[model samples]
Target: MEFFTIKPCKTQAAYVVEPKKPLHLDLKALKVPFDITARTPVLMAMRIDGVDVSLYPSGKMLIQCDEPECIAKKVWGEVA
Candidate 1:
C-alpha cells in the first residue's frame, strides 16, 4: 500500500513506509510515552491492535505484525 511496506518478521509481517505528508502529532495531547523529537521527531514506539508501531517526523513509519499490510491499511484508513 502507499502508506506502508510489508516485510517478513520472525513471528509475523512488518511494514515500513512514509506517509504522503508529515503527521502533526501532539505528544502531550496524545500522552505519547516515547520520544524521538530531539533529533528527528520520531515516535518510533507505540502499539496498535497488539502490533508494534513507529512514526517519524519525516512521515516515515514502521508497523510490525503478522500481515502488516492488512493491519496498516485498517489502521491508517481509520486514522485518516
Candidate 2:
C-alpha cells in the first residue's frame, strides 16, 4: 500500500482512487470543516480487502489538520 495525496488548490477536492487499489493513509492530521471542494485535500493510497497502508505526503502544502473519521466515512465510505 502507498499514500497518494492531491493538494487542494481551490479546484480539486479529492482524488478518486480507483476501486481495488491499495492506498495507505493515516487521517490523524487532516484539516476540518473543509467543504468537499473548498479546503485543501489529500488522497492517500490503500487496498480495499486488506494490506499495509503506506503513507506519502503531497507536493502542495496548506493549513494541515487531522482527517476526521466522521468526514472520512461520509466521503470515502470508510476511514482508517
Candidate 3:
C-alpha cells in the first residue's frame, strides 16, 4: 500500500510526508529497535539511513537532508 506522499516544503532543502492515516508508533516499543532517544505523544525524532527524521502522530513527517525528494520515498519505504 502507498503509505505516504512526499512534497517539498516552502523552506529550502526540506521535505514533508503526509500519510494516508495517523501513524501507530509506540515509542516505548520502538526505543531500542529504532534507537529513539526522545519522544512525546505528538512527536518522535530519530535517524534513519543517516538522515534525520521527525515524525508526528498525525502522520506527517519532516525530513531534512541534502538528498533529493527521492530520499523521502526511500525513507517511507523503510518505515512503512
Candidate 4:
C-alpha cells in the first residue's frame, strides 16, 4: 500500500508528505544519508541533496526539494 501522500506546498519548490494513517516515527533510529541538523523529541531537521527536510513524530515531512516524491519514497521505504 502507499505509505504516504504528497502535496505541493503553497510556496515554490516545496512539498508536504503525510502518512495515510496516524503514525509515530522515531527520528533517532531513522537512517538516512543526510545530516540531522536539529533534532528533538518531536521534530528532526535535516538537509538532503541541498534541500531542507523536517520530519515530525506524526510521520509528516516537509521537504524543500525539486523531487519530493522521490525523496518521500526513499524515506518511507527505509521505515517500512
| lDDT digits (tens) for residues 1-80 of candidate 4 | 26567887778667889888756777777776677899887888987667788888877889997778777776667665
Tens digits of per-residue lDDT, candidate 2, 1-80, equal 12344333354443322223443444445433333332222543333222212223322122222342223233344332
How are the candidates ranked when ordered by TM-score, highest leading? Answer: 4, 3, 1, 2
Ranking by lDDT: 4, 3, 1, 2
**Against the true structure, what is each candidate's TM-score?**
0.48, 0.19, 0.63, 0.76
In candidate 3, how many Å is residue 12 off? Answer: 2.3
Residue-wise C-alpha lDDT for candidate 1, range 1-80, written one tens digit per residue: 26533455435456565556656654334444333333323354566667677655444557775466665565456344
- Assess each prediction's global lDDT (C-alpha) against the native: 0.53, 0.32, 0.63, 0.77
**Which candidate would rank higher by TM-score, 1 or 2?**
1
What is the total number of backbone clashes in candidate 1? 1
TM-score, cand. 4 vs. native: 0.76
Q: Tell me how candidate 1 scores on lDDT.
A: 0.53
Cα error, residue 59 of model 2, in Å, equals 16
Against the true structure, candidate 1 reaches a TM-score of: 0.48
- Identify the leading candidate in terms of TM-score: 4
lDDT score, residue 71, model 1?
A: 54
Report how far residue 17 has shifted in candidate 3, in Å. Answer: 0.7
Q: Considering summed lDDT, which 10 consecutive residues are worst modelled in model 3?
A: 26-35
Report the C-alpha lDDT of model 3 over 1-80, residue by residue, as the tens digit. 25456777888667787777766765444432344546877777867667777777655778787653554465456555
Model 3 accuracy (lDDT, Cα): 0.63
